[model samples]
Target: MTWEVRFSGFGGQGIVRCALITGKALSMYDNKFATMTQSFGPEARGGACASQLVISESRVLYPYVTLPGVLVALSQDSYNTYEPKLRDGGVLIYEEDLVQPKEDTGRVQMYAAPVTRMAEEIGNRIFANLVTLGCFAAITKIVSAEAMKNALPGLVPDRFLAVNEKAFDRGYEYGLELLETRPLSIEEAP
Candidate 1:
């Protein structure tokens, strides 16, 4: 299987870190081939930022996500920019707190999760990225929840280790719930 995932948002939203964690999880725990890349504007906050991933069963030859199979939009600006790039039938996961789906787009499957709310509920706003990652894991099954959990300590700072782990677990479970109700098919690209 091959997957190209794009995570985009404002600079301070942790798009880059999220991408890194994903790559690390794939490489270290899942034992899959993965590559990650990113682009960002000048400002640290409110600037456009995007992180891309390419994962495969064999050695990944490219590090860029040309036509993403999964797109994660963490802000309205991100939705506006990358939503058009998703391949037909691709999966899009967006932050419900910041974006309202464009009802007219029928080419892709979209899921909205309140990542910020989930993070806040877990008592740490910084874990929003982890929550979103969990959502991705749950929906895609690209990385197992066990692998993600095992990979966390290396990705997060020592001070935030515990809560971030909880946040990831919550997101993963939330994703799994969605999957149980609406499972995705694994057909080849048309």
Candidate 2:
């Protein structure tokens, strides 16, 4: 099966890097194939940004996402912009501190976390992206935590590796706890 995922947020939030890391984890460490594409808005820093990744067990023919099955929205603007395009029965993940979903998510499944708040507990808010990635890994189980951790060394600066790993762990642990403590309303993975 193929999974199309979109990571969306304002610029300077490492939105594009999320796709890059996930693609690397799936393709290099998890033995899956992945293709990634990214977009940035015209505004300098706070503009909308998004990155798409297509992951499959086999080779990926297309480089762009046609119908995203997973949507990670780290900002209100991004959630509003991409939520409508999510495929039916898709999974939607968002930053609870930054985004708020509508009363209904249609047939889509929804999960939320305070990614930025979690990052602040570490060193800075910059690592929220990594935290979100970890949450995604646990919530989706598309890639193992070890694989995602393995793909991190080169992507993050050597000095900040430890902190980034901690951020990831925090999110992963939180997600695992969520799964274990709460019941999922959705039936299947999209």
Q: Score candidate 2 by lDDT.
A: 0.89
Q: Give the TM-score comparing model 2 with the true structure, all chains together.
A: 0.93
* Tens digit per residue, CA lDDT, model 1, 1-190: 7889999998888899888888888888888998998999778788999999899889988767888889999999899999999888888999999987799465887788899999999996778999999999999878887877777786788888888888988999888887777677654632
Q: What TM-score fits each model?
A: 0.94, 0.93
C-alpha lDDT values of all predictions: 0.86, 0.89
Question: How many steric overlaps are in each model, in order?
Answer: 0, 0
Which ten-residue region of model 1 has the weakest summed lDDT?
181-190
- Candidate 2's residue-wise lDDT over 1-190, tens digit each? 8888999999999999999989999999999999999999787699899999989888988778888989999999999999999988788889998897898736787888999999999889999999999889988888899998899989999999999999999999888876776444544434
| lDDT agreement of model 1 with the native | 0.86
Best by lDDT: 2
